[model samples]
Target: MYDHASRPGKPSSKEEDAPSPDKPPEPPITRIPSVLPDAETSPAATSANNTTPASGYAVGGGEDGGDNGGANLRRASTVPSPHFALPLWRKSVIIMITSFTALSVAFASTSLFPLTSEIAGDLGTTPVVVQVTNALVLFTMGCSGFVWAPVGRLAGRKQAWIGASVVFLLCTAGTALAPRAAEEKTRLKIFVAMRILSGFEGTFFHVTGQTWLADIFEPTQRGTATGFFLLGTVFGPAFGPCISGIMVTYAAWTSILWLQCAMIGVGLVSSIFFLPEIRRPGDTERRKAATSSVLGILKEFNPSPVFKVMLLPNVILTDLTCGLLSWSQYTLLAAPRHLLNPRFHLTTPLVSGLFYIAPGIGFLLGTVVGGKFSDMTVIKWIRIRGFRLPQDRLNSGMVSFFFVIPASCLIYGWGLQYEVGGLALPIVTAFFYAGGLLMAFASVNTYCAEVLPKSRTEVIASKYFWQYTFSTAGSGTIVPMIDAIGIGPASTIGVAFVLLGGVLTFITAKFGLQMQHWAQRKGVGSP
Candidate 1:
């Protein structure tokens, strides 16, 4: 039987492991615990009771307390207890709003792709220049997590969401209005600047919004909630082109920006009224101690801590695995346009764009099903081990890693290389390839959020930092690799990387608990 009362940092002994005969055995855990009756009060809460003034904040206890000393402190000081439940309908609304917010940001990032010609023609610039603006938006969005994560840590996540949304809205409006400039160079400069500004919005949706979901949902339900949240992200790129293609056909290019602004405005308003604050005043006070001054907050901005998290074996393995997955992901996204257009002898953009819908559907199914599967896997492991470890969730994605992805990539690549079954085979393979990517992604992504629950925001930021860097590299290099080597060989390389990632994930799952214990013992990555 598992001992629920054991606290982290307490020395292990036979007594600690043995269940008491005097008390009856507790029932198996099927639902989240509603109270932390056996847990200690948070350090901040204890301090507040003594000399420090009460900040009127309630803190929640950790789910499992072993070897999570700093995590316990952070969670106990910041997050509310699961007992403070939101109504089911309210939770549903929050999920919908968050998904929509993610969709709006993601839509803007790629919506410009289908409008490149129209935007170029309107601004008196070349199509390549307009494309560069889109690239800049992506690059800026990837790096902005470093800035937003810390701000969310220090001030509050709720404020960060609203502020980023508002800025995104204003930037969309500015981009829409940029065409009115008299000089072509001025118009181009204004448009690019506004796009760069808008890029800051992406991390809020991807990083902070996911963090918010983690805050509200218990471990049992997180997989499904995360899957739902990922829908916005998975479909955005595919839907962006599809929606923009239609909008540009019927309306002006500027109309796309206007629509983005309206969507963002709705998100901003919804967040302000509906989003709950996970970090209360006492939590902010505790955070302030970590960043006591303006200089202290500036010091917190350094990326060293985020990089230091990579020193942990589990975190590095997770990061590298995510990077490899990203390479495969971008490969699929980049291939259709380049390979399909020439092979099919296609001229229309709409027809080529239609190919995206297949992968989009695949990603959606993968995340939703994958997430629920992950939770089930965790429960199964918990029953077998008689206790839970965060890494138990990783096993759920192994099939995707080992078989589903490799087979799909080979089928997609080799099929296209040989033109074996025309468009149907590759298109079908692409769907499974995308499905496998996201199935693996949902597990790894949720694991990242839970791995260091205390420093989740920063940990997630680091994951994105490495993941996007690889994605940028993949996006830039895949076309060249395909040009130099045959599509089959280029994709074979991606499959090999995915295999390596699967091996790493396996190592992490089998030995992660040991590694985490060692790190805690050595005072490395305590949080």
Candidate 2:
């Protein structure tokens, strides 16, 4: 097994990962797996002579939790080789398919809403018992983030996707078909297990899809690509409940899961035929050096890498910021159904469902525009500095984080308290707040890949790790919190979270590179 054996002592400044401004920025994404004596002198080392090191060669980190200097082994486990140089049209297609898959998974996450009672009746249990399953599914999705990368590294990226899809399909089927002929206890247990298992596939799609898009696009254009890719994620949750609400009115509650199954089928079929392999590097020695056995990979598989990644100042701080943002994001999303129906004497599920559309539109506009602006910022920064750093793009999303989200959060929360603008004003605030949320999400999502490109999978996965954790907390507590303190106080709490997150991101944008450089010296990340 490859090990990130740390160098014995603090190294000189020259040993730091920071590159000279005059020289072209070394691709920081991937590396050669084993630090072998004869490896660099071998034929493979000679080949990388012509291309970019980090991006061009397409290496990945090992299961042991650090960069292994390995260029992709066969597109070794998902690192897209720049040598392949896919066409723009082909890359767009890849992004589209992955985005659709992400959307489908996002849909699955929430489509069961308002059906808890119906499902519980079938299982001879209370709606409350069935509803807890939703939270568990969400929790499971977050937990699964840690698994996707290691399994991808061990099996191959394509295989990992296919395997997760297959498992998800089977689990969905099980959840949907909980054996009505069986006893209630038995049926409920089967349904619960299957639903939880299906959760495993959700974050894998969301986080890994981001990394996959990163695999194909360069840093200069990744924000735009990521923004487009986020369409599925941003819209899925918004539409899922609406569609499910309408569907349950007309069809079986299980029909929602069945519909989700059909969507997953479409995505799976598209991927099976069209999703390109991350192609391996050209040299024979490089392939040999990058290769590893599945058993060996699993033996060394330590899930701690996800946690260890948090130790980095940039990662943890940005993640902390993301955590706070998520607290507000979920709060906004969860608030509407609770706020809208009672406030205006709106009784129908459909009417409450309509409220989600406001944020959905905001999410759409925010992602598309935010993505473009982030890329624009990257190009502007590169032109000014003569090179790009991962943190350069963070400045683009600051408007959303600092001004847009905070302001919108306060307005949305307080408007309901004082009955300020009726429903119209609150809907508008929801739209902007949701927009601000995705805008920040787009920036941070792309940054995860660049921050530790070699360990791109882990970095991205771990971000979701913290993101889901905060989101779950917000969803679980916000309604009760509001009931106790009123919407005004609840929103004030959310705004506080937004401001703190904003300050943290500002710190990162300004000093993240220095923090990352210091972490490299301390072996904090794979830098």
Residue-level error in angstroms, candidate 1, position 362: 0.5
Candidate 1 lDDT trough over 10 residues, lowest sum: 34-43
For each predicted model, how many residue pairs clash, with residues at least 3 apart or on different chains? 0, 16
lDDT of 2 by residue, 1-527 (tens): 32121123544233566687898766433222321111211112112123344322222233432222222211112433472278999888888899898898888877776456678888888866765787678778887876666567656678788888888888998889995646878999999999989988888988778877776776667889999999998788777777777777778888888888888888899999989767344433433434555455555367777778788888988888777887887777665767777889976666777777788799888888888888899778655533355777788888887789889888888889999998899989989988898888778777776777656677777888788788778877777789899999999988888888878888888867557546755766652
Among all candidates shown, the one with the greatest TM-score? 1
* lDDT for residue 265 in candidate 1, whole number 0-100: 88
Model 2 residue 68 CA deviation in Å: 26
Model 1: residue 353 alpha-carbon error in angstroms: 1.4
Best model per lDDT: 1
Score residue 194 of candidate 2 by CA lDDT: 94
Alpha-carbon TM-score of each model against the true structure:
0.82, 0.81
Q: Compared to the true structure, candidate 2 yields what TM-score? A: 0.81
200 in model 1: Cα distance from truth in Å? 2.1
